[model samples]
Target: MAGEPQPSGAPTKGGWITFPFLIATMAGLAVASGGWVSNIIVYLINEFNIKSVDAAQIANIINGCVSMFPILGAILADSFFGSFTIISASSLISLAGIVLLTLTAVIDSLKPAPCENGSTLCMGPSKTQLGILYTSLALSSIGVAGTRFTLATMGADQFDNPKHQGVFFNWHFFTMYAGTVVSMVGFVYMEDNVGWGLGYGLCVAANLIGLAIFVAGKRYYRLMKPQSSPFTRLAYVIVAALRKRKVLLSSKSEDYWQETQAEGTKFVRTTPTNSFKFLDHAALIIHGDTNSDGSIKKQWNLCTLQQVEDLKTLFRISPLWSTGILLSTPIAIQISLTVLQVLAMDRHLGPTFQIPAGTMMVFVMLSSSISLAIIDRFLLPTFQKLTGTSATPLQLIGVGHALNVLSMAISALVESKRLETARSYNLNGNSIVPLSVFWMVPQLVTVGVGEAFHLPGNVSLYYQEFPKSLKSTAAAMVSMYIGIAFYLGTAIIDFLQKTTRWLPNGINDGRMNNVYWVLTLIALINFGYYLICTWLYEYQNVERKELSKSSPYPC
Candidate 1:
């Protein structure tokens, strides 16, 4: 298979493909990326002399960029270059960013001088210095987005079997979470105890190594050819549907345009589903819509019924996807706030060992990792056995919502207790509360459990439900939700700061309990909305099964 004819960079269709190379690259990149990102808030505050809340906001913005660009990456992979080219290029970009970040740590001139003790005034980074920092963040964030989700598609491309694909996805997530844990614990500890220079230098090395390993396995990867943009087809369907809005939809399948190779050959045709009947107009054949040979006359003004229905399918699933944004927003808020809480609480495990504030998120990642295994191995199978049917994605999402609401309540309670402890200890200003940081673990674990249920469920649902042509976009939708949520979290924090005194620079002064209460209410409301949407939604693949069983076309 390796000797078979193929393009210069692409491997043959059949061979021992290098999926492990992709996985290893993903793991290394994940570690390097997570190391910097997880501790960015602390770095900005301690080194760059930014305010705590401002640093958190900046971190959220960076996270938003990282999450958002994957859609663009997916589009580029599907329409222009394949995943291999994109990943290679993005990895190089990331390495450059990490190198720049390393410079800020190594060179004292690149950063503002450390604040003097008992000084109220501290100098922030100069505009030029900030520009350099922001540039590095932009490059690294975009680079991470490009490689992370796209690699999932590339790895799955290596396998022909659905079972193999499922296994790959499981391991992909496992490696991702494990890498995150390593960065959050080991790398963050190094940054806190040793030096930022050493920590960031390690990140640069990891990225370079990941890139080198990826490039070395060039001949062992199964590459997919780029196709024409599916977005264009979707646009044509919309334009055609609007142009033919008054055209009556026919019950007979013959009236709709089905694909044919030539005059005498016909393709296996699917009848448009009864849902979204208005979109069916796009497929209704008008006298001037097609050529004599049955090709489209005006590319933008005419489309097949299948094309129109494909657009409708996207429309159907959109509300459900929007629910994920709401689901993630509170989780984002929790992560940032949890870090802030750790900063203000007793993080010491013993007389000597103290946990880094940035590393508190380890609880969430740890809980999520374990929950993933339990959900896959025990919970899902038991549920299926009890019900005599596998739980639908919607049901899994509903479970997640319940757990999130509970988690928010727990967060509120913990904060309330912490606030009481602060008050009791006379810790009014710049003093850590006497409360133990372990109080945050339960809420973090709860949210992690919610993530374990909904993250995979949402990804699986989108991948299964989206049109075959839009599979890359489907995978990217999850990233879109997370990106939007991070931005939304930032906005929510800003809003609270402006409107209320719930989130001051110091956690000791701020009424964080109220913020958690607000999030809990919102999560509950969002859950209700999700439930209504779930009730209203119907699966779109029934027609495909029916079409496969019996042809709509007459002989």
Candidate 2:
């Protein structure tokens, strides 16, 4: 009890230390796997003699599912399994998958033989040889998605005390980016030279090492117990909605929609409340409990359903945040699509001077890293001074979305130039795009702008929307939205590719510039939607009060 968090298993200094280590491990494994995965596309295309777009789509489809699978993990974590167990177990599952993937590289499928040199895990002769490869990828994705939310909440448990809360968040984001930096550079080079098997093997090793670190500090983690399934509450909501619908249509149901006038979350009615009173779902913006001296104090009180329901609550108040997920969908493309655009199309330099396609990731990494650092070093303080408190995270979100919109337009036009150049010349070998690569700098820079806005806002928003106990689940909710959008984005792209003739049959011959132009148009629409939702995004209570003091009202 002495070391345990107040509401959970005993907290110890060890748990806190172990908690971050596990998280960092997770971060390293996730991003590093991603780095290798990106390079793997080049290997698959070269090794198998597949088309470029085919390789791109294969990568896209597999990763697209990563975001959506977390919901299953969240559901189980919220109900049957606690965070610690799920994370550890999932990591083990993923580690197995990684081993199988490495084996594929050495073992040959044809004639029960191996690769030219005869290895154990190398692929077989046909496209079917990749089936096991895909399975391994799926397993890793499952492990990652399942444990992602489980561990994040586990980490937040360390800083529930208000004093360390702000610092905890700042460090959390920092550690995440730090893990990303290491993986991006280290994994890419390894995957490029060694076969896919060894590169993937390294990723498994990273995850396992992180898991081992997590085990050492397990005593300090302050793991919370699981709760009842959220489906029950969702069922409750459905019944309530149905009952309300009947009442509304029958002209007697308005009372059903009213807030439980008593403050308790759930209360059954003997009968509908009124002859004339209409339920106001939007009204009664639930006020906080006040102390005897007029100060406000916060309490976290809820069940599994209540915790999960908070996502709906978050959506209600921060409609923009939910829609903001769509705006962010392009980001998943940062590694795959944007990389393709730069390497395959950008025409700024001649063949001799063109940057190696893989090197383009440096720009993406630079944008995310430098932009985040600048925000902390300069941008945050400058905004704090100028807007006082009113310039909130939501305000930054609007600015970020604006940048996303701008970048899309730039990519459409500049990338188009590269395509035009290639089409005009008969040169097939060592073909490079034209003046468009220079324009990538601005688009890439804007990626940083978008990151600075969305990352903090999403984190803070998820944390603020839920009670402290359910913070992890809330984080899952945020991630799930992104995941769903990601899966949807890939499916949409695939459907378009097959249904449309815009893409030529050759591997390197995608109408990439046209594709980006269409995406640019979509970004503008997403920007408009984000703008509409901006009025609803909120800041955390502490930040809100501090900002309230400013002379002008902005947030």
Candidate 3:
């Protein structure tokens, strides 16, 4: 009765009923996050009098922390607190951080004196100011870590059908991007035209509204209880395997420790496969390894066959996972560099209106949102109808990889042209290039389209393949790699600054085009690496044939 489907049309705790609240909450948080994060580079340069390169470096580090802290959040959600608790607590933390940030904007003592136009002598923020700024950033980053992907897992958990889950993920990303686009355009405009105090005050208001909506949905949610730590079980398998290194291999299913369900239910026994055979030792039954009733006797010295296989699954998927790091690193580098590029180029749309440098990324978010909708509504259906089978996650990811390489190539060419235009005008030493900033839009749109293909693909692949017990952690893996990529991007910039003239403090004086070219090469190499990883990888949870039949737009 517990696992059986509810009767048709029966009332359910979660379904489309929770959609409005969840989507609203997601949009609200996205606006709040994008408002501050998108403008931070400009804020530091204009308000704090930090150098352009130094501001980019600081932004990269903050992005890294925001992305990386999701693992800790996921761990806590999976092992102790359920997603609801984490989301609630994190929302409050975000509100507090946003309030503090608003205070800094309003209070003169909290930031450096405004730098005069064309003046090189500018005072930086004091230690006390920097400390407060860092504290607010830290709190906000922690808040983002907890709620971003955790919300995805929680929303997906509401449905029993994988097809519905996949659709939800698509819309989830769409809502996120749509919110970002709004912030990039509206809030950034506010910050540029009105004042930082009003812009940040709006972010604080959005956070409060989002938190209230999320709390209002408590009754509609089908909340999953926290389980024992999946990481601990993974560790047990490793420890047990090493301890029983001398044990002989077994081919018989009965030799392995298998778990049995309820008495009335039929239990299917599974044997360890030949892949990663050394790990099979952990599942091999030994004296005193289990109690008389088949209960685990020593947690570290013995593990279920399922536990061993879960660890193997992680090992097998690791190469594919590693490829994501390289996949995202180039994008990270382009993001920070593009901000710098927009600053030096003319951003005017007409004689009366000029585009804010911070709002330039709106192109990426807009493209990604539109692309996601098109993919879900048209492309996927067309592909399925033509082939009588759905496109696989790996196929989508491969396409994304190819597109990313092209984006980098285009970025390099565009940056080169910008430099040429500057030289033609006899520009030097932080002078604005005569070229229009729209030149960067093509590459930004390209990367955005690539993200639409790969980001949800990666999340879908991990969620479907990972052990059910580690679902929250699986969703957070994307954040982890993105975090690593941001840090890697920072390191790459630092290395170039120290060793070469590729990334000078004043980007106009440096060969920024060469930097983009290097990223293009790196992306090409990484794409090749991704191919190899996908070639050898097999789907562990969903069979290829079954997956094709289930959903036209599977993840």
Give Cα-based local distance difference scores for all models.
0.84, 0.57, 0.87
Question: Per-residue CA lDDT of candidate 1, range 1-555, in tens?
Answer: 012256688635523367668789988999999899999988998899888888888988998999899988887987899888999999999999989998998899988999997787899999989988998898888889889888887887777776777777777877888888899898999999999999999899889888989998887777788777788789888888899898877888888887555777666767788788888888888889888887889967778876887788899999999999989999988888887788888989999899998888888888887897787778877876786666666677789999999999999999999999999887864468888889899999999999888877787677667887676576578889999999999999999999999888877888999999999998999999999998998767644344233211111
lDDT assessment of candidate 3:
0.87
lDDT of 1 at 291: 85
Roughly what TM-score does model 3 have, to 2 decimal places?
0.92
- Each prediction's total of clashing residue pairs, residues at least 3 apart in sequence or on different chains, is 0, 24, 0
| lDDT (Cα, tens digit) per residue for candidate 2, span 1-555 | 122445456333533455457556666656645555556566555555444556666666656656667777767776888777887888787777667666766565511233353222444346566677677777776776666556655565555554454445455555655665566566655665555566667777787787787677676666667776554444444443333333322233322223234675576433332322222121111234335563323222111223223335543555665665667666555445665565555543565454434555566567776776676667777877786644555666677777777777776676566566766774343255443555567777777767666766665555555545445455556666677666666765677688875455341455656766676777788878777666545443345685455422111
- Model 2 local distance difference test score: 0.57
What tens-digit string does per-residue lDDT give for candidate 3 at 29-58? Answer: 989988999999988888888888889988
Clashes of 1: 0
Best-to-worst order by TM-score is: 3, 1, 2
Model 2 regions lying over 4 Å from their true place: 1-20, 48-50, 110-127, 163-169, 229-235, 240-315, 342-359, 387-389, 428-439, 465-471, 505-510, 535-555
